[model samples]
Target: MPAAPLSILHVVRQFLPNRGGLEDFVANLAREQARLGHRVRVLTLDRLFSAPEMRLPARETLEGIDIERIPFFGSHRYPVAPSVFRHLGDADLVHVHAIDFFFDAFALARPIHRRPMVATTHGGFFHTNAHSRLKKLWFDGPTRMSVRAYEAIVACSDSDARLFQAIAPGTITVIQNGVDLDKFAGAAAPEPRRALLTIGRFARNKRLDRLLATMQALNAEGPDWRLRIVGVPSDITAAALTAEIDRMGLSGAVTLHTGLDAPAVRALIGQSSLFVSASEYEGFGIALIEALSAGLVPVAHPNDAFAWLKERHPLITLADFADADAAAGAIRGAYDRLARGEVTRGEDLSDYRWSGVAARYIAVYKAALAEAGHGVAATAA
Candidate 1:
């Protein structure tokens, strides 16, 4: 029997212009599945702030995947969208992005669609230290309800899977986020730029403040290294961080680069000696994967995913976040080792490539459909 062609649907807040690991994964996987002959479509929120003039009508096609963006009212915190439920009825399977933001909206809309859904927790909202009760209430209440609605759950790391299970227990799959190897290859000769780079949104959980403190402490010790921070910027917070950087006299030593494309980021990684991430918690360190592919030794806090890989690959040097001085020393040591070629990069990164990641998603998609009692036969796309 020929395999059934899946009419898969992916729901998220945004797809293009704003690029995060989950968004990249969905977009890449959608394209690959489309190439494999499955009909895949993406439903997203057309947030005004991100794309003010984005007149994405009710329907459009992007790279063989159908793209639909409904205007949703909420930042990454509490989403309120009425139209999302109406759209869910049209797919054989639904793949949701981010649990905390879209969970309530999806839960409310689930009965209308009656389709089997799976969620990918993209981190940030759940793990961050709560400053207000409302944030906790919003997360805890909606997460419990959302888990019941989902037929299955997936996380980018084993730790993430555990976090997901805290809400709903089941067979949670660990599909690590992947990178485009072709986009990041070793330059002809990696020049000794002796620079450190960190990439991600300037969110509190990212613990960039700690990293800056580490850099300042390192400067005091001896190694005069430059630190480059890159990502999208929030104006008010950027001003505050800039003021602090100026106050610390780190304006010359630390450079903040914003809104860089993937190619640009890879080029920057190629020039840098080491990539440092002090994220208190991350679902999966896609930035580290990118850095590793570009020949930048990764220096991270003792994250579960980092520790899990540290046993096998010597490329990553894990450090304790509480000891800023020790973290700084580890960064310096890794930098020196990378400079002298004493720490050679090892590990087969092919499994984390987009193609491999897409194949894994295909396996999960098949499993979800199967569990939902949808019979899918093997057929060439």
Candidate 2:
């Protein structure tokens, strides 16, 4: 007989239609769990500032997963929803994303639920200066404490796992993030165009300003490629980016896009010759996987998250992000090789499909339940 489906609850700072890797990861994982005949629900903050134009119902179902948005009352983007604890009692297992901010509350509430709990630390801490030393000091204790509360901690990459191991030490599982292979793979041959592409949130950590500088250098050297930056830009970053483009006289060579759906994004990638990432860090490079699946040559900074990918496929160009001259040269060399048919797209990533990812999560969920001595719940007929 087939095993019973479990009740899985995911707690995160935010969810779709907030466009970020974490949001997308939770949405896809929840949807996949629901599709696998499990009772899946998402608990998240109800905030409008991020994507005000895309109004979402406070309580609704999407792609078969139940979503509940709790109004946040705290100032530092930390959510304070007492009702979240009340809802926790209904779940067979709870999976929290990220160790900072809102999830500290979830950790405190986990003992009351007495359900098997898992936490996926999406990235490392101590890499950014945006969080003041005092803020980091204040949250650091809770973050470590919360991580220790989990029965299992999922890390998206080796680097992410190492960071968590430094504090919580055990129960770390390295599960790299998955991409939708069908949505990205087997595109019609990319049309010849002097175009470069990068897709991510326009946050300071993404280091897009460095990418802009590289584009400026490349244009000056005569390759004359247009860079398409596809992401929602912050007001401050948008103003800065526009100013830099104008100051560098790259007005005609760069374009910004926001609010693109999946198909639109894939279409854009299919037309571009290269995909670039200048992120200071990543737990896993989902955008890089998407680029490889779409058969676009990828160039990125030498970050540890891409170490596994680089090992598996040696052709991915890694450059020193601190040196624009060197980074631009690497990108130009890759592009010229592509034009000359000397280099090809990276390896196939069909193994990272959502079906396989969901299966891995299900195994972890079953293990968590077994460890807690709870029988898996039956699936609805």
Candidate 3:
């Protein structure tokens, strides 16, 4: 006799229409969970942080997963959406994405919902150095207290594992993020060019200015390398980025892009030689995975997450983007190696496949359910 399917509920601050690693992670995991014969539903805020003025439908279904959006009140830093309680009726397991309000709220309401809960720490709130003292207090106090409610904590990177492990010992399981390989698979040029690509939110920590400065230094050395920055606006506006480009005398070599469909972005990736990022922090480097999938070499800042990635894949090179000359030299080194055909493009990311990642999460879900005394099958049925 077959076991009954599990009903999984994903509680995230944002979803699909807002593009990012966390959104992609939830979307892929939910889709894979649904595909594996489990019922999956996503509950997110109605507003997109990048496009606050826009409103999404209250409820909808996509890729076989039901999605429900609740209105949030506080700032994006910690949007409060207690209305999620009304939607948890049929869920056997509640999987929270990131360590924000939902993580804490659902933890407090666990007794009411009577559902097992697990959380994926998508690089937590310390991305930037804004208010370090208070952030530490909140993490050591509220976050430490809140995480106790979770049956398991899925850390996306080794760096994240270290952080969460300190507060919640023996609770973390590191599962790296997955890439939508179909989006840019084999989209790179046959012969790499002297162009670069960077994609993500135009947040302050992305350090786009440092990338532009690196481009300036690289150009001064010779080859006339070009840069294409593609992303949506967040804390940093497009106007500000454009001004920085003009100010650095890179108006000619650097290009700024805000909105582009997948095809358009893929086209830019095809035209570019390599993908690069100067982000000061990342919970996990999703862009690097996407770049490797697209057959492009990645030059990134040696943040804890990127450093962790570098150890896994040799084609990924770490550079100090803060020092323009040094970063430029590293980029040149990558170009030389690519030209020599010494390093090939692409990494067999079977381990990062959504099916595998979803399986890992499913184990956590089953453990959580069993811990709560739910007589559910622990198998991946």
Best model number under lDDT = 3
What would the per-residue lDDT of candidate 2 be over residues 1-381, giving only the tens digit for each residue? 126777788988777666778888998888877777777889887774455445467887766668888765665244466667766647888898876554676668666667788888888454355766865665467677777667788898888888778667777888878787667675524655678899887777788878888887888767478888887764335667778788878889888778898888887776788889888778788888877887888889888877678887777888876788888899888888887888766586757888888778777777777777785554222
Question: Candidate 3 lDDT, tens digit per residue, 1-381?
Answer: 116778888999988777777777888888888778888899999999888989999998865668999998988889998788998868888889998999998888877777888898998899999998999999999999999988889999898999999999988988878767778899987796888999998998999889988998898866489999998888988998899889888889999987787899899998987889999999898888888889999999999999988888988999999998999999999988988888877688667777777777777777888887886654764
Ranking by TM-score: 3, 2, 1
lDDT assessment of candidate 2: 0.76
Each model's lDDT comes to 0.72, 0.76, 0.86
lDDT of 1 by residue, 1-381 (tens): 126677878887767556666667788878877777777888877653434555566677765668887876655455566677667645788888876456656666667666777777776365566665765675467667767777677788777777667767776777877676666666312755558888876667778788888888888856577888887643225667788788888898888876688777776676687888888777777777767777777889887767766665678999875677998889878877766768766457887877677667777777777777775533433
Each prediction's TM-score versus the true structure: 0.88, 0.91, 0.96
RMSD of each: 3.1, 2.8, 1.7
The stretch of ten residues in a row with the least summed lDDT in candidate 1 is 47-56
Candidate 2 vs candidate 3, TM-score winner: 3
Candidate 1 overall lDDT versus native: 0.72
RMSD of 2: 2.8
- Pitting candidate 1 against candidate 2, the one with the higher TM-score is 2
Best by TM-score: 3
